[model samples]
Target: MKNYTTPILILFLFLVIAIIGNITISAIGLFFNHDVFNTGVYANGYEASLNIKLIFMAKAFALLMFIYSVYILIRNLKFLVRRDFFNNKLVQCFSKSGKLFFFSGIVGFLASICGILNIAIIKDFGSQAYLNIDSKSLYIMLMILGFFLLLFSKVLDKGNEIQQENDLTI
Candidate 1:
Protein backbone atom coordinates (compact mmCIF):
# COMPACT_ATOMS: atom_id res chain seq x y z
CA MET A 1 0.00 0.00 0.00
CA LYS A 2 1.13 3.53 -0.67
CA ASN A 3 2.27 5.65 2.25
CA TYR A 4 -0.50 7.72 3.82
CA THR A 5 1.60 10.78 4.47
CA THR A 6 0.39 12.72 1.42
CA PRO A 7 -3.28 12.17 2.19
CA ILE A 8 -2.66 13.08 5.80
CA LEU A 9 -1.00 16.31 4.83
CA ILE A 10 -3.79 17.23 2.45
CA LEU A 11 -6.46 16.47 5.01
CA PHE A 12 -4.61 18.45 7.64
CA LEU A 13 -4.42 21.48 5.36
CA PHE A 14 -8.10 21.22 4.52
CA LEU A 15 -8.99 21.05 8.20
CA VAL A 16 -6.83 24.03 9.09
CA ILE A 17 -8.41 26.13 6.35
CA ALA A 18 -11.91 25.17 7.47
CA ILE A 19 -11.13 25.98 11.08
CA ILE A 20 -9.72 29.38 10.19
CA GLY A 21 -12.64 30.24 7.92
CA ASN A 22 -15.21 29.17 10.49
CA ILE A 23 -13.55 31.21 13.22
CA THR A 24 -13.43 34.30 11.03
CA ILE A 25 -17.07 34.05 10.03
CA SER A 26 -18.20 33.30 13.56
CA ALA A 27 -16.24 36.23 14.98
CA ILE A 28 -17.65 38.62 12.39
CA GLY A 29 -21.18 37.43 13.04
CA LEU A 30 -20.82 37.85 16.77
CA PHE A 31 -19.29 41.28 16.41
CA PHE A 32 -22.19 42.60 14.39
CA ASN A 33 -24.96 40.96 16.39
CA HIS A 34 -23.63 42.01 19.78
CA ASP A 35 -25.39 44.72 21.79
CA VAL A 36 -22.12 46.58 22.14
CA PHE A 37 -22.47 47.86 18.64
CA ASN A 38 -25.28 50.39 18.71
CA THR A 39 -27.38 51.05 15.61
CA GLY A 40 -25.80 54.43 14.98
CA VAL A 41 -22.18 53.34 15.39
CA TYR A 42 -20.71 54.38 12.08
CA ALA A 43 -21.65 56.47 8.98
CA ASN A 44 -25.31 56.66 9.98
CA GLY A 45 -25.45 52.93 10.89
CA TYR A 46 -23.43 51.46 8.03
CA GLU A 47 -21.26 49.41 10.40
CA ALA A 48 -24.30 48.11 12.25
CA SER A 49 -26.03 47.19 9.01
CA LEU A 50 -22.87 45.60 7.69
CA ASN A 51 -22.53 43.60 10.85
CA ILE A 52 -26.16 42.50 10.57
CA LYS A 53 -25.51 41.22 7.08
CA LEU A 54 -22.36 39.52 8.33
CA ILE A 55 -24.36 37.70 11.01
CA PHE A 56 -26.58 36.03 8.43
CA MET A 57 -23.60 35.41 6.19
CA ALA A 58 -21.72 33.79 9.04
CA LYS A 59 -24.65 31.48 9.79
CA ALA A 60 -24.68 30.37 6.18
CA PHE A 61 -20.91 29.90 6.19
CA ALA A 62 -21.12 27.98 9.44
CA LEU A 63 -23.59 25.56 7.90
CA LEU A 64 -21.29 25.11 4.94
CA MET A 65 -18.36 24.56 7.26
CA PHE A 66 -20.24 21.81 9.04
CA ILE A 67 -20.94 20.14 5.73
CA TYR A 68 -17.26 20.28 4.80
CA SER A 69 -16.40 18.77 8.17
CA VAL A 70 -18.65 15.81 7.47
CA TYR A 71 -16.86 15.30 4.20
CA ILE A 72 -13.52 15.20 6.00
CA LEU A 73 -14.86 12.76 8.56
CA ILE A 74 -16.11 10.44 5.87
CA ARG A 75 -12.85 10.60 3.95
CA ASN A 76 -10.85 9.71 7.03
CA LEU A 77 -13.26 6.96 8.01
CA LYS A 78 -12.88 5.42 4.58
CA PHE A 79 -9.13 5.52 4.91
CA LEU A 80 -9.33 3.79 8.28
CA VAL A 81 -11.59 0.99 7.09
CA ARG A 82 -9.10 -0.47 4.66
CA ARG A 83 -8.21 -4.12 5.25
CA ASP A 84 -4.55 -3.42 6.03
CA PHE A 85 -5.35 -0.42 8.16
CA PHE A 86 -4.01 -2.05 11.32
CA ASN A 87 -0.58 -2.63 9.79
CA ASN A 88 -0.38 0.64 7.94
CA LYS A 89 1.09 3.67 9.67
CA LEU A 90 -0.72 6.11 7.38
CA VAL A 91 -3.95 4.28 7.90
CA GLN A 92 -3.43 4.39 11.66
CA CYS A 93 -2.82 8.08 11.48
CA PHE A 94 -5.96 8.51 9.45
CA SER A 95 -7.89 6.55 12.07
CA LYS A 96 -6.58 8.69 14.89
CA SER A 97 -7.32 11.85 12.96
CA GLY A 98 -10.70 10.43 12.00
CA LYS A 99 -11.68 9.88 15.59
CA LEU A 100 -10.81 13.46 16.42
CA PHE A 101 -12.63 14.63 13.32
CA PHE A 102 -15.63 12.61 14.38
CA PHE A 103 -15.71 14.41 17.70
CA SER A 104 -15.41 17.70 15.88
CA GLY A 105 -18.33 16.72 13.70
CA ILE A 106 -20.40 16.04 16.78
CA VAL A 107 -19.59 19.48 18.08
CA GLY A 108 -20.40 21.03 14.73
CA PHE A 109 -23.68 19.19 14.65
CA LEU A 110 -24.49 20.47 18.12
CA ALA A 111 -23.71 24.03 17.12
CA SER A 112 -25.85 23.68 14.04
CA ILE A 113 -28.68 22.38 16.14
CA CYS A 114 -28.35 25.30 18.51
CA GLY A 115 -28.40 27.73 15.61
CA ILE A 116 -31.52 26.13 14.25
CA LEU A 117 -33.18 26.19 17.62
CA ASN A 118 -32.32 29.84 18.01
CA ILE A 119 -33.84 30.60 14.63
CA ALA A 120 -37.01 28.73 15.53
CA ILE A 121 -37.24 30.50 18.84
CA ILE A 122 -36.81 33.84 17.16
CA LYS A 123 -39.64 33.02 14.79
CA ASP A 124 -41.88 32.02 17.67
CA PHE A 125 -40.86 34.93 19.86
CA GLY A 126 -39.20 38.15 18.71
CA SER A 127 -35.81 39.86 18.56
CA GLN A 128 -36.54 41.63 21.84
CA ALA A 129 -36.72 38.29 23.63
CA TYR A 130 -33.71 36.77 21.90
CA LEU A 131 -30.30 36.78 23.53
CA ASN A 132 -27.07 37.21 21.59
CA ILE A 133 -23.84 35.40 22.43
CA ASP A 134 -20.56 37.08 23.20
CA SER A 135 -18.09 36.90 20.30
CA LYS A 136 -14.94 37.04 22.43
CA SER A 137 -15.88 34.12 24.65
CA LEU A 138 -17.02 32.04 21.71
CA TYR A 139 -13.83 32.77 19.80
CA ILE A 140 -11.68 31.87 22.77
CA MET A 141 -13.49 28.59 23.27
CA LEU A 142 -13.22 27.68 19.63
CA MET A 143 -9.51 28.48 19.56
CA ILE A 144 -8.96 26.34 22.61
CA LEU A 145 -10.82 23.47 21.02
CA GLY A 146 -8.78 23.88 17.86
CA PHE A 147 -5.55 23.70 19.86
CA PHE A 148 -6.65 20.49 21.50
CA LEU A 149 -7.45 19.02 18.15
CA LEU A 150 -4.01 20.02 16.94
CA LEU A 151 -2.49 18.19 19.85
CA PHE A 152 -4.49 15.12 18.99
CA SER A 153 -3.27 15.34 15.44
CA LYS A 154 0.28 15.44 16.74
CA VAL A 155 -0.34 12.23 18.64
CA LEU A 156 -1.61 10.67 15.45
CA ASP A 157 1.56 11.72 13.68
CA LYS A 158 3.60 10.06 16.36
CA GLY A 159 1.52 6.91 15.92
CA ASN A 160 2.35 6.98 12.24
CA GLU A 161 6.04 7.29 12.95
CA ILE A 162 6.01 4.40 15.42
CA GLN A 163 4.11 2.23 12.98
CA GLN A 164 6.59 2.97 10.22
CA GLU A 165 9.50 2.03 12.45
CA ASN A 166 7.75 -1.16 13.50
CA ASP A 167 7.14 -2.08 9.88
CA LEU A 168 10.80 -1.57 9.03
CA THR A 169 11.90 -3.80 11.88
CA ILE A 170 9.62 -6.65 10.80
Candidate 2:
Protein backbone atom coordinates (compact mmCIF):
# COMPACT_ATOMS: atom_id res chain seq x y z
CA MET A 1 0.00 0.00 0.00
CA LYS A 2 1.95 2.97 -1.28
CA ASN A 3 -0.90 5.39 -0.43
CA TYR A 4 -2.81 5.96 -3.68
CA THR A 5 -5.46 8.06 -2.01
CA THR A 6 -3.90 11.40 -2.99
CA PRO A 7 -3.27 10.50 -6.62
CA ILE A 8 -6.66 8.89 -7.08
CA LEU A 9 -8.44 11.85 -5.52
CA ILE A 10 -6.53 14.23 -7.73
CA LEU A 11 -7.34 12.26 -10.86
CA PHE A 12 -10.99 12.00 -9.83
CA LEU A 13 -11.22 15.75 -9.28
CA PHE A 14 -9.65 16.43 -12.66
CA LEU A 15 -12.10 14.10 -14.37
CA VAL A 16 -15.03 15.69 -12.57
CA ILE A 17 -13.97 19.14 -13.74
CA ALA A 18 -13.61 17.94 -17.32
CA ILE A 19 -16.99 16.24 -17.18
CA ILE A 20 -18.64 19.33 -15.82
CA GLY A 21 -17.15 21.48 -18.54
CA ASN A 22 -18.27 19.07 -21.23
CA ILE A 23 -21.80 18.92 -19.83
CA THR A 24 -21.98 22.69 -19.64
CA ILE A 25 -20.82 23.00 -23.24
CA SER A 26 -23.39 20.46 -24.34
CA ALA A 27 -26.12 22.29 -22.52
CA ILE A 28 -25.12 25.60 -24.07
CA GLY A 29 -24.95 24.08 -27.52
CA LEU A 30 -28.38 22.54 -27.03
CA PHE A 31 -30.08 25.72 -25.82
CA PHE A 32 -28.25 28.15 -28.10
CA ASN A 33 -28.39 26.01 -31.24
CA HIS A 34 -24.63 26.18 -31.47
CA ASP A 35 -22.46 23.76 -33.43
CA VAL A 36 -20.30 22.89 -30.44
CA PHE A 37 -19.57 19.40 -29.06
CA ASN A 38 -20.25 17.55 -32.29
CA THR A 39 -23.79 18.72 -32.67
CA GLY A 40 -22.80 18.95 -36.33
CA VAL A 41 -24.10 21.77 -38.44
CA TYR A 42 -26.28 20.77 -41.30
CA ALA A 43 -26.81 22.04 -44.84
CA ASN A 44 -28.74 24.91 -43.29
CA GLY A 45 -25.57 26.24 -41.66
CA TYR A 46 -26.90 25.56 -38.16
CA GLU A 47 -28.35 22.97 -35.83
CA ALA A 48 -31.69 24.65 -35.53
CA SER A 49 -34.24 21.94 -36.05
CA LEU A 50 -36.21 19.23 -34.23
CA ASN A 51 -34.10 16.38 -35.61
CA ILE A 52 -30.89 18.06 -34.58
CA LYS A 53 -32.25 18.71 -31.13
CA LEU A 54 -33.28 15.09 -30.67
CA ILE A 55 -29.92 13.79 -31.79
CA PHE A 56 -28.08 16.26 -29.57
CA MET A 57 -30.26 15.30 -26.63
CA ALA A 58 -29.51 11.64 -27.19
CA LYS A 59 -25.80 12.33 -27.28
CA ALA A 60 -26.08 14.37 -24.13
CA PHE A 61 -27.83 11.53 -22.34
CA ALA A 62 -25.14 9.14 -23.41
CA LEU A 63 -22.45 11.54 -22.28
CA LEU A 64 -24.00 11.77 -18.84
CA MET A 65 -24.21 8.01 -18.52
CA PHE A 66 -20.62 7.54 -19.63
CA ILE A 67 -19.37 10.15 -17.18
CA TYR A 68 -21.39 8.67 -14.33
CA SER A 69 -20.00 5.21 -15.04
CA VAL A 70 -16.46 6.53 -14.84
CA TYR A 71 -17.26 8.39 -11.66
CA ILE A 72 -18.63 5.28 -9.99
CA LEU A 73 -15.69 3.21 -11.14
CA ILE A 74 -13.17 5.68 -9.73
CA ARG A 75 -15.05 6.37 -6.53
CA ASN A 76 -15.18 2.73 -5.55
CA LEU A 77 -11.48 2.05 -6.02
CA LYS A 78 -10.70 1.89 -2.30
CA PHE A 79 -10.81 -1.88 -2.43
CA LEU A 80 -7.54 -1.84 -4.36
CA VAL A 81 -5.55 -0.81 -1.30
CA ARG A 82 -7.69 -2.56 1.31
CA ARG A 83 -6.61 -5.94 -0.05
CA ASP A 84 -10.29 -6.64 -0.70
CA PHE A 85 -9.94 -7.25 -4.40
CA PHE A 86 -12.73 -9.85 -4.32
CA ASN A 87 -15.40 -7.91 -2.53
CA ASN A 88 -19.06 -7.62 -3.53
CA LYS A 89 -18.92 -3.87 -3.46
CA LEU A 90 -16.17 -3.74 -6.05
CA VAL A 91 -17.93 -6.26 -8.26
CA GLN A 92 -21.17 -4.34 -8.07
CA CYS A 93 -19.35 -1.15 -8.87
CA PHE A 94 -17.85 -2.61 -11.99
CA SER A 95 -21.05 -4.37 -12.98
CA LYS A 96 -23.25 -1.33 -12.65
CA SER A 97 -20.75 0.92 -14.35
CA GLY A 98 -20.29 -1.56 -17.13
CA LYS A 99 -24.04 -1.82 -17.74
CA LEU A 100 -24.55 1.92 -17.74
CA PHE A 101 -21.65 2.46 -20.11
CA PHE A 102 -22.91 -0.26 -22.42
CA PHE A 103 -26.34 1.31 -22.53
CA SER A 104 -24.85 4.72 -23.16
CA GLY A 105 -22.73 3.31 -25.94
CA ILE A 106 -25.84 1.90 -27.56
CA VAL A 107 -27.59 5.24 -27.35
CA GLY A 108 -24.57 7.00 -28.82
CA PHE A 109 -24.37 4.41 -31.58
CA LEU A 110 -28.00 5.05 -32.50
CA ALA A 111 -27.52 8.79 -32.43
CA SER A 112 -24.55 8.45 -34.74
CA ILE A 113 -26.59 6.30 -37.08
CA CYS A 114 -29.39 8.81 -37.20
CA GLY A 115 -26.91 11.61 -37.81
CA ILE A 116 -25.32 9.73 -40.71
CA LEU A 117 -28.67 8.97 -42.25
CA ASN A 118 -29.74 12.57 -41.90
CA ILE A 119 -26.54 13.66 -43.58
CA ALA A 120 -27.01 11.19 -46.37
CA ILE A 121 -30.55 12.40 -47.01
CA ILE A 122 -29.51 16.03 -46.98
CA LYS A 123 -26.49 15.37 -49.17
CA ASP A 124 -28.64 13.60 -51.68
CA PHE A 125 -30.29 16.89 -52.48
CA GLY A 126 -27.04 18.90 -52.30
CA SER A 127 -23.78 19.17 -50.33
CA GLN A 128 -23.76 22.82 -49.51
CA ALA A 129 -22.56 23.48 -45.89
CA TYR A 130 -22.93 20.07 -44.39
CA LEU A 131 -20.14 19.33 -41.95
CA ASN A 132 -20.51 16.16 -39.87
CA ILE A 133 -17.59 15.12 -37.67
CA ASP A 134 -19.31 12.66 -35.37
CA SER A 135 -17.16 9.55 -34.86
CA LYS A 136 -19.08 6.27 -34.95
CA SER A 137 -15.99 4.43 -33.81
CA LEU A 138 -16.09 6.16 -30.45
CA TYR A 139 -19.33 4.48 -29.45
CA ILE A 140 -18.03 1.11 -30.60
CA MET A 141 -14.95 1.54 -28.48
CA LEU A 142 -17.08 2.39 -25.47
CA MET A 143 -19.07 -0.76 -25.98
CA ILE A 144 -15.90 -2.81 -26.02
CA LEU A 145 -14.62 -1.18 -22.87
CA GLY A 146 -17.93 -1.76 -21.10
CA PHE A 147 -17.88 -5.42 -22.07
CA PHE A 148 -14.37 -5.78 -20.71
CA LEU A 149 -15.41 -4.23 -17.43
CA LEU A 150 -18.31 -6.65 -17.17
CA LEU A 151 -15.98 -9.61 -17.68
CA PHE A 152 -13.58 -8.21 -15.15
CA SER A 153 -16.38 -7.98 -12.63
CA LYS A 154 -17.28 -11.60 -13.19
CA VAL A 155 -13.71 -12.68 -12.61
CA LEU A 156 -13.56 -10.66 -9.41
CA ASP A 157 -16.82 -12.22 -8.24
CA LYS A 158 -15.40 -15.71 -8.69
CA GLY A 159 -12.28 -14.69 -6.84
CA ASN A 160 -14.45 -13.40 -4.04
CA GLU A 161 -16.21 -16.72 -3.76
CA ILE A 162 -12.91 -18.56 -3.59
CA GLN A 163 -11.56 -16.20 -0.95
CA GLN A 164 -14.67 -16.66 1.16
CA GLU A 165 -14.37 -20.41 0.93
CA ASN A 166 -10.73 -20.31 1.92
CA ASP A 167 -11.50 -18.08 4.86
CA LEU A 168 -14.26 -20.38 6.08
CA THR A 169 -12.00 -23.41 5.93
CA ILE A 170 -9.28 -21.65 7.87
Best by lDDT: 2
Candidate 2 residue lDDT tens string, 1-170 = 53777787788778667666665665566566555544245326654556766776787678778878988987787787777788899999999998988898999899878777767775431221122323578788889889999999999999999999999999
What overall lDDT goes with each candidate model?
Answer: 0.47, 0.72
Q: What pairs collide in candidate 2?
A: none
- Scanning candidate 1 in windows of ten residues, the lowest lDDT window is 124-133
Q: Please report, as a residue range, the 10-residue window in candidate 2 with the lowest summed lDDT.
A: 124-133
* Winner by TM-score: 2
Q: How accurate is candidate 1 locally (lDDT)?
A: 0.47
Off by over 4 Å in 1: 1-48, 83-145
Score every model by TM-score.
Answer: 0.39, 0.77
Query: Which residue pairs collide, candidate 1?
Result: none
RMSD of each: 10.8, 4.3
lDDT of 2 at 45: 61
